[model samples]
Target: MAKTQEFKATERIEAPQGGPGRGAMGGGMVGQKAMEFVPSGKRLAARLRPDRGKAVLVVLLGVVSVALMSVGPRILGHATDIVFNGFIGKQIPPGTPESEWPQAVQGMDVVPGQGVDFDAVAHVLMIVLAIYVGASVLGWLQGFILNTVVQNTVRTLRQDVEDKINRLPLGYFDRSPRGELLSRVTNDIDNVSTTLQQTMSQLLTSVMTVFAVLAMMFWISPLLALVALVTVPMSLLVTAQIMKRSQGQFVAQWRRTGALNAHVEESFSGHALVKVFGRQEEVEAKFAEENDELAKVSFGAQFVSGLIMPSMMFIGNLNYVLVAVIGALRVANGQLSLGEVQAFIQYSRQFTQPLTQIASMVNLLQSGVASAERVFELLDADEEPVDATGAAAPGRRGEVAFEHVSFRYDEDRPLITDLSLVARPGQTVAIVGPTGSGKTTLVNLVMRFYDIDAGRITLDGVDITAMPRAALRSQVGMVLQDTWLFAGTIRDNIAYGRPGATEDEILAAARATFVDRFVHSLPDGYDSLIDEEGSNLSAGERQLITIARAFLTDPALLILDEATSSVDTRTELLLQHAMAALRTDRTSFVIAHRLSTIRDADLILVMEEGAIVEQGTHEELLAASGAYARLYQSQFTAAAVGEEV
Candidate 1:
């Protein structure tokens, strides 16, 4: 069996917390309801700005759509008036309507007990049909307008979300889990679109619909209308109470969902490592725990939100019975017409219909709000700005000097302190140290990846802090310890440094680095796809490709941080050749722990902790019998006596 490779213990990194202010929805249920759809004002602005022209149209259409829908009850009330007028002319009683029914319908073939006027009945029927047709057409128009509104609004929101992600700072990605971020950007945003796009429009229409129906009902009979209106607040109070209770559940649901997604992404991203470690069962248990918690929260949120519709209907139905009884008594005393009583019932139903819809929308509104807040948090994260004033492009000499530089990744933990070094033009400087020493930190200073908390760095006798970062970086080439290659053809990666380079220049760079020989050995040469991170190729091959890229750039300064540490002796020799070829006319800085690697360097600096402890030529350092001498005597003295060392 092969040995299992164990990684260094996983270290936890805490990202700063962010979101919006608390809303009026009541406590942690705000988080707990069903999601943490924390709405952010800035995120909303960003989302609206991209397709602002279309968003304006969508909001306008939504307004017009609601306005149109609000007219339905009014039209129905008009039909009721027409019915009332016919009943008045016929004088039909509730129980003795059969003989008089024909009288109401033009008095045709009057039976013994049918009291309705036949002609009157016909008139009411025609009026009802006309009202129905008019209402239907208006409803269809409202739907047409809102369909454009919803679809366009969603498209605009999604595009902005994607754009925000692309423009976000690299540091934002370092702390955030990829799956959680992905969930908010793609999955959560999709839910927000579905949840609120229609609800927002309907919330307006629901208010209007309820008012229009109430006004008509009051006109018919204020006493009965007042009775119906009482139940409305009751419905609202009930909905508000449920919404309050459900907030925490929703927040918990989103939190659990994010955790679940994080687990899935981690499991998938490290599938090979997991298989090698035989951690499948352990991973499965963790995933199941997260998923189970998510399901619970989801169910709790849904269960509470689901109560609103049915409760609303029950309250409205109870009010309906009360209105009917009271309306019949008013009619018996000749204070109400039969049509007026019928219209009252219709208005009552209309009032509750919108109430039910609005209740449903509140849940989704909170969810969208939660999601919006997270999106805005990312946009608001602080980013390093491009140096503006007193900043110029890097000059040709590339004389990099770190003067009394000190740095710490955190406020309390200093990694490099009061360290000073210089790299001259056309010279090769190598940094060596024990593991966890500040060897790599020196190279990082040259690139200005993290600015020194104290002291300053300069290039060509100019302060680097005063130089435009883009211009400074343009002249420097870097080969990182972690190799990251995009999923593109080999030629594309090589040409990434100089997009407009001629074929001859690319071939020259490849040949100089001995990359062309290996590339030509492949089936497709430079056109072959390497997939993500060059997984199809050997580690050394990927390093060679990156070396070709650096050569293509022809940067004035080059940095190789443990550049060939992973390769075998044979490949290391080829790398040495590649490095020697590239360093002939440019300044270079190499970071390695190996003692033999620094033998050809123009200058060597050995670090301990965050301080440079020794500096000199290889033979001088060996003669001094210090830290460098000890390191060399332990590892390289025997090799240098005879071989390629």
Candidate 2:
């Protein structure tokens, strides 16, 4: 039977302190904060290090594109100068280029009687258009390269997560919530992907644009450029303040999202149980509470980050007005041309545009960093111990022994100590125990699901730990109390036991386990489809399929842990006969609550509190009249009283 461990509600719902969800929504102690922003951001960036070559290429493209776009305003300013000079110079005498004109036209290049240089202006406009087109083309190419890099990086991250899941010890799954783990794998990774896709290209372009446009601004008019630079500090102050306030909320939002997803998954998976217990209102109330918390944090994050762009724009407009006034005065004093002033004003707008963009991207960057930290935590978890090098392989004779083995799930609480047992070749050993008596745990040790802390377990006198886990487990087959079936045809599910089994072998195993009795009656025989949940099959039918699956492995040893507990009396009797045949010439460990099922076994072990209290044939154990005798008598009395009622 599967052993159930007791845990507090809080333990199931929350991660350990200082883990991924240590923020406000994670139910940490008061005053605890999420992970620091800079470290998490740096860790996220490290994931992209493998693609640094591509990243550098993307940066180059962005710089070149911004450079091309920045010169357009200067070219357009030249066209403006041509028109202004022509208007002022029309009143001068013909061919009077002798620098004797009025102050407005003194420094201007004007031709007498020339109303306006339409041809020159058109030529300049065309050059500006070509520059913009080149910039657009480079921008598109940069986006394409960046998309490839981001997608490849995220793909590698997903594969790493998948591999890590396999390496994690089974105990990790026992302590962690299924929904929370799923949220990390699916929701958090996806958030990271989206964040990278949306922000990477834009951020690169925005920062480059800031530098390129600022340089152009200084080239056009240093005084106006300085005036524009004044707003830089104010923009930085606003962004820093807002980002500081919103960073925690962004972390809290993702954590709350995970918690809510966990609750929803648990409720739905146990929907029938919740209805049986009449806890629908309580479940809904909890859902509402979590949903409300998620909404509040999400709102706070968006609202705070949303303040950045407007503040930047406000500061930018002030800079623009100040520049326009000063440049106009400079033009009037003949210190700068009207065209230069026009170009400087345009450069000022371009400069602030990128700052606003950077401000707007703060929310995405923060959220992405939060999710990336969660993923990193999963990757950094301690994995199961590595397999021994040059490992031995177990012999197929099926002789198993535990020599003074000691094991415990926790350091301070010992479960099994100084336990020793032997199962000889081809013998059926039945283990009878109450819940938490270490029956299943003993089987787990035999399979090396959890390693023993002291002493050695051997198969055919070869230490199991010395053998690779695959080699050791290949010799054994297990049938658990829970029956799991994926979405596939019945034949496919049966063949999963031994992937390359022939049709005849599948049929033989099915007949031996009595799965063939009902399989042939279905509409498609072995080809009938089963849903992911296997809801179409009865409980007994599901157990029969699992038994057939175990039979197909043709293993040297078999474990049946409450395998027939779900079947009815008639089906149980049939399975007992089938199992008796399957156990021939193979060592078998049968864990059962029903004494009648193991009466004919070669050996029976009565275990209590992780130690064997009695061992003998059923008749011999009954003759001793010990703990086994009391348990049998109590069960017999209860059955007799129930029949009388």
**Among all candidates shown, the one with the greatest lDDT:** 2
Predictions in order: lDDT: 0.70, 0.85
**What does candidate 1's lDDT look like per residue over 1-645, in tens digits?**
112222112111121232111111111111112213333533454554555665465455444444443444454544554545544434545455544353333322323333445565566566656656665565555556555656666677677667776555443554456667777777777776766566755775677677767777777789998999889779879988998777666655665566577668778978999999999999999888777778887888888878887898899789989998998887666576555677677778777888888887777766666556544454455556557686777798878888998987557778789888888898999888897687776776666665678999999998888887778888898887666677899888888888999899988888876678788788998898889868888887787778788889989999988877767788788778778878987899988777666689999988888888999898989899999988877776666666863
Error of 1 at 271 (Å): 1.6
Clashing pairs in 2: none
- Go through the candidates in order and give the C-alpha RMSD of each one to the true structure: 7.6, 4.4
The numbered model that scores best in TM-score is 2
Candidate 2: worst 10 consecutive residues by lDDT?
A: 22-31
Cα error of candidate 2 at position 121, Å: 0.7
TM-score of every prediction relative to native: 0.81, 0.93
Those runs of model 2 whose alpha carbons end farther than 4 Å from true positions after fitting are: 1-34, 91-102
Cα lDDT of model 1 overall? Answer: 0.70
